[model samples]
Target: MNDMRMSPNLALNQLVAQRRAAGESLVHLGFGESRLPPFAPLMERLAAGATRNAYGPVAGSPEVRAAVAGYFGRRNIPTGADQIVVAPGSKPLLMALGLVVPGDVILPRPAWNTYAPQARLAGKHPIAVAIPEECGGVPDPAALRESITAARVLGRDPRILILTLPDNPTGTLAPPALIRELCAIAEEEGLLIVSDEIYRDVVHDPATEFLSPAEVAPASTVVVTGLSKSLALGGWRIGAARFPHGPWGEWIRSGVVSVASEVWSTLAAPMQSVAEYAFGEPEDIRERLRASARLHGAVAREVHRITIAAGARCRPPTGAFYVYPDFEPVRAELGKYEVTDSPTLARRMLDLGIVVLAGHLLGDEGEALRFKCATSMLYGETVEEQQLALDAPDPLALAHVRSLLERVEEGFMRLVP
Candidate 1:
């Protein structure tokens, strides 16, 4: 416990701020925060709820819960307000899942940095399985079965499986076929699935088939999402979850609310107001999400191009705003700078005025020369500049945004030559 460091992304953001405050020209690609400005109507809603300050229901306000229910219902998952539970943020809901769910946890290797740590804090062992090559967020179907067997062999009760949709760090969505395959495995193993779909609304391509494990295995899967990413409301801390409608689901929900009662008590009143409006999928909110998705896809693709051109192997980001570039192809060249591993590679980039979270911190092998580059942070250093980038006809072509992109490209170039 004493050995654990702060969450890598948060810790990196702090480091970047400290460096910049001391006058370093740091290009922050470390944090996963969406740098977009908050929607105006949402702000009005927050203000409207400001005077209604009182502790709400432990699960959530009925209006907000219903809105979240509809949010899932529209996605083909039949949900009800009774099945929904809201929390300060999806992070707390996830940690509560870790605490209430029985057995050790199974995670996709190189997953969001918080998952394993949450599991440990919940007093559960975390079993990491490598992701499939085609995408991230879900474990390699083949590897998962073996890992489960190995865990049980070691007397570990492997019962809970956590998955990300449009995964963090990698920014890729698992295909529907893969989701179905993994769901089948979960059913076979009798494992409860905790699906973190926080980025589901941020998918770069709307036409791209996105499948949620809850849809495929509703009986065993619990779905969680929040307004943080799509609406850029991270600070508002509005998150909600949909449990399967049954005795088991009710049991899980009750247990989570119990944990919530002891921990966060309830989602703040004002944020719940924000969540109600956002989850209702109002027309303005829908349009804002579409535009934000376009911006994230565009900048992420550009960074992917730069990384590939710089001799790193990177998956084309299909969703979210991240690209996990593996620098293994340039091992020999990087060796010249003694960048033989992920930590060294990260340090090398930082020395060149670029900040990225080392892959190892997200559960990748330390020996791998890889790091997670968050393109969202490249929008701008100020809210006004970010709004301009968001509104530009061609954001990447905007002078300020272009200059930032150039800085990123220049940083990558330094890595190779």
Candidate 2:
């Protein structure tokens, strides 16, 4: 606890907030939050349940769990209410899983910053493997096998693997074939898989292919998701997880519930009401997700173009609202401005009134000139404008949004050229 500071994403959000509060005009692309207003129905549910004040169940109310189960069922995964657990947020649920799950953790090189910390808190060593050239969430399959072998040879126990669908920082999804290959490796090594699908619904293109490890390695995988990104309900603090069937899955779910009982107690009574309503996937909720995805895609693509135009190589974003751009190709040019590594590169951008999360913060090599740029914050600043962005046929056409994107492009043009 003493050695660990606040999570970099959260810390960056705070720094940006303070800067803005003091009247600094800056473009914030560091935090990975789904910056949208809550849907009215979801908020209504919270207000409707305000009268019901009780701790409810540690694993969440049977009603909400069933709603989450139905959510999975509709997605083609057969789930039972007994296999679901709801908590204040997926963060705690993930922490509980880390605690109950044994041995070391294997993570994609540039994963959510939270995973490595959770592994450390659980007394497990986190082994980092570079992701495949095509995606950011799952590790490169061949590299995964080699890393596992190397860890075992060094007398380490690599027992678990974590994957994010529509990953943060990179905003790209791993294809189904890669998922299957990774699942095979997990099965071969007798490893448990934790699939974080919080951003599953945030895919920019409805036709994009997504495969959950649970689908391929059902017996060995558990899934955790929440309304934070899907419904823009981050502050409401509602999260749910679906465990697999059979004895092994049952045992693991029990452990997480036990931990939840002592920790969060239960997702707040009002939020459970919110979860039950949101997880039911009403048509309105579905449409809101669709609109949000559209807006995110528009902003993210423009950011990618700006990076490319500035001579940085970036993976095209297909989901979520982030783009990981590597400035290594322009390292010599940036060196003229005293930017040599990821940290300095981020600082130089911040100096230009554009804040980005440096790639090194996400577990990449510090010397590499890379950073995570989040486009979610570029949406209109007010709820009215946000609603306009949601309703607009082309959010990029909105003057406020376009102005911000212009701010980013102009900032980059000055620094790079």
Best by lDDT: 1
Which candidate comes out best when scored by TM-score?
1
lDDT score, residue 39, model 1? 88
- Model 1: residue 239 alpha-carbon error in angstroms: 0.6
Each model's TM-score, in the order given?
0.99, 0.98
Model 2 segments more than 4 A misplaced: none
Per-residue lDDT over 291-390 for candidate 1, one digit per residue giving the tens place of the 0 to 100 score: 9999999999999999999999888999988999998898999999999999999999999999999999999999999899989998887889999988
User: lDDT per model, in order?
Assistant: 0.92, 0.90
What shift in Å separates residue 216 of candidate 1 from its native position after superposition?
0.9
lDDT, candidate 2, at 110: 91
| Tens digits of per-residue lDDT for model 2, 320-401 | 8899998888888899999999889999999899999998889998999999988888887899988888889988888988
Residue pairs that clash (backbone atoms under 3 angstroms), model 2: none
